[model samples]
Target: MTEPEVSDSLKTFGVVLKALRDETGLTQEEFAHRVGYSPGYVAKIEQGKRFPPRDLAERAEPVLGPLAAKLLRAAARSLTRKVGLASWFHEWAAIEEEAVSLYAYECRVIPGLLQPEPYIRAIFERRLPPLSEEQFESQVAARLARQSLLEERPNSSFTFMIEQALLERRLGGDATTDALIDNLLTQGARRNVEVQIMPLRQEDHFGAGGPMYLAETPSNQWIGYFEGHDSSLLQTDRKAVSSMLRRYDKMRAQALSPRDSASLLEQMRGAQ
Candidate 1:
């Protein structure tokens, strides 16, 4: 039987892993034993038939030292490239995964990190050209995968300011909206998360430019991301990112407080 094809990124990852293992002067079986996996499993990873586990990089640090961790991080980055995300958004997604802090202001839908599965499905179903079965599933998986960032970095902070109109709109009917609000409330209660509402009645809005995302990188630099239907832009210019950060802060000031936001969500849930 013909072997299944491997993605270029995965193949490159396998090559790097094989090189690293060779440099360690240990056989594949020995390395696998150290990492607490079967030799066959290690061989599959080295041959590009399997992806490394999320903790593999950290787990290899003690035995193989820092270089092993770096290679594993590179391999993880390679795996992210194979996801169905748009090319324009790939760089920003990688930065987002490592952000020390994230701020989001949305005028349309809830941010992907806070969206419920039903709401996410409804949003995709409304695509103009419509997605095929495979496309739809891949998009869902990619979006859900991003939520891991919230739990992976306990020190990371996240703030989401969503337009009240979106909540009131009830995009996927009452049931979906109810579930979505409940999910948001649960996320809001987390120590590292702050969810605020941009009241529809506000006359002074700093976010007139539409949705925007800002994140502070691991190196302490700030970046901005903006997206539309067919294109997205990632901003690294200090002036531009700083300006967006200021506007985000102002928008937060205009929005309901976190406490009030939770109360409003509760009221909406009660009304339903």
Candidate 2:
């Protein structure tokens, strides 16, 4: 595991060890002996002073018992939940963090995962109910933090299918749309991010269903997340994920190629 993943793993191990020891009512020495590790080693792991080896986790699983391992996984998930601003948001963030590839379709605007700060702020400012300045900034910070995934080593592949109308939405007026479109063109050149514009003429496109994101992890598991007026759903069911995947595939086929997409953006900029 890389440093970040290892750090996350250590925290997971520490929480698990502490929970298991408490449940078994066993001293460190007792637990270590049963798991075939030295007492000091177990203590170090429980304190998060060191990361337990994967073998250790496998061995400890049986020693700690099924219930303990299950609880440990749940505890790790609980830690992640606290970081998500909303219940549904956490699930999406966690999955996105672990994803190795991303596919998305957006009808009305840019997807938040790829949006620049100015565009994001403009969207927030136009919220129907409006937000306090502090709340708006806090949400902006959260959104920016989520963008860090784009900077990860061995960057995840991103394919975003957005409607052509999104380029004309003047949330912050012409300059904002121009800048945002320019940013999209810049990102489209990156080897990692693949951006496409669905022509306004494609009224029968698969994306007509709605906006959705399909994320695939290194382990090959797929998840779907779709945002709504006041809520979001992190879909884990294979059938649902497959359905979204099909939609994304069709949308990709219908959207203009990356080069053409960039050219289209340039035309919009000149027209503006």
Q: Pick the candidate with the highest lDDT.
A: 1
Residue-wise lDDT of candidate 1 within 135-184, one digit each (tens)? 78777777776676676566789999999999999998999999899999
Residue 22 alpha-carbon offset, candidate 1, angstroms = 8.9
lDDT of 2 by residue, 157-208 (tens): 8888888888766778877787788778877787888899999898677766
| Candidate 1 wrong stretches, greater than 4 Å | 1-8, 11-80
TM-score (all chains, Cα) for each model? 0.77, 0.71
Task: Give the lDDT of residue 58 in candidate 1.
Answer: 75
* Candidate 2 stretches greater than 4 Å from native: 1-84
Model 1: what TM-score? Answer: 0.77
TM-score of 2: 0.71
lDDT of each: 0.81, 0.72
Q: Provide the clashing-pair count of each candidate structure.
A: 0, 0
Cα shift from native, residue 186, model 2 (Å):
2.1
